[model samples]
Target chain A: AQRVTQPEKLLSVFKGAPVELKCNYSYSGSPELFWYVQYSRQRLQLLLRHISRESIKGFTADLNKGETSFHLKKPFAQEEDSAMYYCALSLTGGGNKLTFGTGTQLKVEL
Target chain B: DVKVTQSSRYLVKRTGEKVFLECVQDMDHENMFWYRQDPGLGLRLIYFSYDVKMKEKGDIPEGYSVSREKKERFSLILESASTNQTSMYLCASSSPIRPARGGYTFGSGTRLTVV
Candidate 1:
């Protein structure tokens, strides 16, 4: 079975501080990893995917096959960057069904 | 832009009542999904359809069922409403061919409350 784990439920950081939302997955085969974000009163949107390897809003996540982790990281936390983040995994070519982690709530303090 | 729309922004239903959550995608994508979102649990897939009239059970599908009579629309049905089923339900759609750009397009979500 495919599973994603996000250890932190809430992560509070002061503005301009570095932020890292941990994400790990359990899958035997090659899997696709994605980071999704939901801002206050907004719809859930895709932040980035491992396949793309492109940074979005200063957030980047590298898929580590050996460690089975895809941690989302940002150089500096911004007030507006506070939101709920989720790590998701999908089979590389298997119909695109996703299994998501519990999620992490990031609070950027002023 | 591709748009996935949920029919309701909020709904309240009594226990044992049947509940229907509708989702429609304007894009010609081939896949549609229904997920329930809770505070700490994030989003759990309830059901998904790859093609019209084809449905598949997701991780948490015991209390839920789904219908997909059309390619662009999928409906999630709660057999019997229960307080445990109260959550924010999201609808999403995506293309199966483009794995690189197959990120789901999601709707605003429907907040369901079972009393």
Candidate 2:
């Protein structure tokens, strides 16, 4: 079975501190990984995808196939960065169904 | 700009009552999905449609049904609403025409409550 796992349920960090949200997956074939963020009173939106390899909002995630991980990281955490982050994996076959992790709540305090 | 809209921002329905949650997208995307977002569980797919009148069962579709009469509209129906079904329902759309970009545009979402 395909699954995505986010180790932390809540991650608190002071402003300007580095942040890392760990994500791991289990799949036999290649998978497409994504990071989605949902802020307070806001809709869930796509933050970034491993395919593009582009950084969004100062955050970057690298897909390590050998490690079966796609960890999201930021050099300096900002107050505005606080939100519920979900790590998702998309199966390349059959419409690319997405299986999301439980999610990690990042609280960046001043 | 691509936009997906759900019919209601919040809905309260009694258990055993039938419920309908409508979603429309103006992007004319070929794929539309209905998912329920829950705390600590993330989003779970309930149903999806690839084209008009075509539907597919997702990971969790036991008590749910869907309709896609038109290209831009998709509807989720709960034959008998249960307290367990109360959740944040989200609608999303993506252009299957472009397989390179795995991006999905989501709606604001509807908070459904069962009494």
Candidate 3:
């Protein structure tokens, strides 16, 4: 079974500090990876996709095939960056069906 | 902008009552999904449909059923609402067109409370 694991339940960082949220996946074949974010009282939206390799809101993630990790990174955190982050995986050409991880709550403190 | 709209923003129901959650997408996406979001569990997929009247069981599909009568509408049904079923329900839609750029569009979500 394909599974996505987000190691941290909560990550607290001061504003302007670097942020890294860990994510690892177990899949036999090649997979498409994604990062999704949900702000307070807002809908879940796509942050970045490995296939696209485009950064959103200063957040970027690189898919590590060897380590099977796709950790989200931000050079400097902002107060508004605090939200619940999810790591998701989908089989290549699987028709957009995704398997999401447990998620990590990122709290950016001022 | 393309949109996925869920019927209710919030709902309260008694235990053992049947519950229906409706989802509609205006983007004409080919796939629609139903997920339940809990504090620690994140978003667990309950069901998904790739085409009209075609439903697929997701990772956690027990106690939940789905209906996709039309291409734009997908309905999630809880056979009998239970306290454990109380959570924020999310609806999402996606398509093969521009899959990389447009990953998925999600609804605002429905917060369901079963007491």
Report the error of model 2 at residue A17, Å: 0.5
Which ten residues in a row are the worst by lDDT in model 1 chain A? A90-99
Provide backbone clash counts, one per model: 0, 0, 0
User: Can you tell me which runs of candidate 3 are displaced by over 4 Å?
Assistant: none
Give the TM-scores of the predictions, in the order they appear.
0.97, 0.97, 0.96
In model 1, what lDDT does residue B79 have? 93
Candidate 3 lDDT, A1-110, residue by residue in tens: 88999999999999999999999999989999999999997889999999888889999999999999999999999999999999999986666789999999999999
| Residues forming the 10-long window of minimal summed lDDT in candidate 2 chain A | A90-99
For model 3, residues B1-115, the per-residue Cα lDDT tens digits are: 6389899999999999999999999988888999989988888989999899999999889999999999999999999999999899999998866654338889999999999
DockQ of candidate model 2: 0.74
> Model 3, chain B: what is the TM-score?
0.94
Q: What TM value does model 3 have?
A: 0.96
Q: Score chain B of each candidate by TM-score.
A: 0.95, 0.95, 0.94
Residues B17-111, candidate 2: write the lDDT tens digits.
99999999998788899999999889999999889999999999999999999999999999999999999999988876544335788899999
User: Model 1 segments beyond 4 Å from truth?
Assistant: B100-102
lDDT of each: 0.92, 0.92, 0.92
Pairs clashing in candidate 1?
none
- Would you list the clashing residue pairs of candidate 3? none
Q: What is the lDDT of residue A17 in candidate 2?
A: 100
